[model samples]
Target: MEEFNWLQLLNPEFYILLELGGVKIGLFVVLFIVFAETGLLAGFFLPGDSLLFLAGIYSEGLMNQFSTHNDFLNVTIFALLVSLMGILGNMTSYWFGAKSGGYLYSRQDSFFYKKKYLYQSKEFFEKYGSKAIVFARFLPVVRTFAPVIAGIVEMDKKKFMLYNILGSLLWSFSMIFSGHYLHAFFLNEFGVDLKHYIEYIVIIIVLFTTVPVLWKILKKQAHIEE
Candidate 1:
């Protein structure tokens, strides 16, 4: 009998997404995270971008562990599955909004349900219209809430579906494939394994995703000062 390493589970690098691969349940974990992050308001704080990228990097090792060959094909399949998860998650969020958004309108502000946040999403949807769906995929909190706002406003379902699919494909494919290729590039060109530097890579990805939000806020403040 062996003692369980609880500390390993607590380590940031030991992300559940990576751990799932070891247990041969990576696909299920990835899909569930994607769905929760996009579909459930409570999931707003999930590390979506970093998780997806890490998944791509670890996926190759996972496949090899299972005696799989043809890295390209495996990675392609993985990317597609992640994309579908994102698309389905947004659709689920939209449906929930359509069914229950009315309740939110009458409710007062609370820790989780802030009228200001909803209003901000509404303003974003109005300013960008359908394009917001595609653009929001690149933004953090906005990505999670854009579909909900669209549903609340009753945007045309047909148009919403088109943008939702496009956004999900763009977001998921970009993150996952970039991780896959970059891992290979580092190993081949620099003779360094990506796993050794994954923490720094995750930090970079976090900053990349968050800089836009910070810039927007700074710009808004500057305008207010003017």
Candidate 2:
């Protein structure tokens, strides 16, 4: 159980160990994870938001533990690299979607395919056209299927790629960098532990995004109900 618990903090642990062991090693792991999650469809489940957030928090810890110069500079570089990886990763997914097209989505039995999400993704593509790619990026489960649906529907490759990359960057980078900067600011200002608030911070961000979208949806619902 202890080993299991420790394993969950693997990225943070790696970051710390790498900083102590060598900066190059630490940076590489971070980049790899970022790219994998953003690009690989199978990697959609990986903890991208949390990893970036933790990376930001860990940056502060690394500064205190080591007499490192330019902590902010280092953190910013880390953030940018991860953000770029995220963009690149989703692009790969988009191309995969383009390449796979209808053939990939035809298999209902594939483990990654879920009836509910596929249906929803279908509805989204039918309703929103190119914008669904953008909107779906912020959704947890839906984001996974959005690209797949785009591929299945044979959405224009150039347009889908543009929106897919934009959405990926906006969603992944914004959450991560926000968490990092917030952690840095709060710690500097209050000298209190912000770790306890991580869940709330994430929830707040999810709601901050989801609520307004929901409101618009509800409003549309009520109009139809009338």
Q: Candidates' lDDT values, in order?
A: 0.77, 0.62
Identify the candidate with maximal lDDT.
Answer: 1
lDDT of 2: 0.62
lDDT of 1 by residue, 1-226 (tens): 3455866432334553344323666556667777877777634456688878887888775455543478888877777887888898899889988888677667797654566556666777898999999988887777888888888889899999999999999988888888888888999998999888877987888899889777877798799999
Candidate 2 lDDT score at position 19: 43
Model 1, CA-based lDDT: 0.77
Clashing pairs for model 1 are none
Stretches off by above 4 angstroms in model 1 are 1-13, 16-22, 62-68, 105-116
User: How many clashes in each candidate?
Assistant: 0, 3
Error of 1 at 95 (Å): 0.8
The C-alpha stretches of model 2 lying farther than 4 A from their native spots are 5-30, 60-72, 108-115, 196-226
RMSD to truth, every model: 3.4, 5.2
Candidate 2 lDDT for residue 127: 83
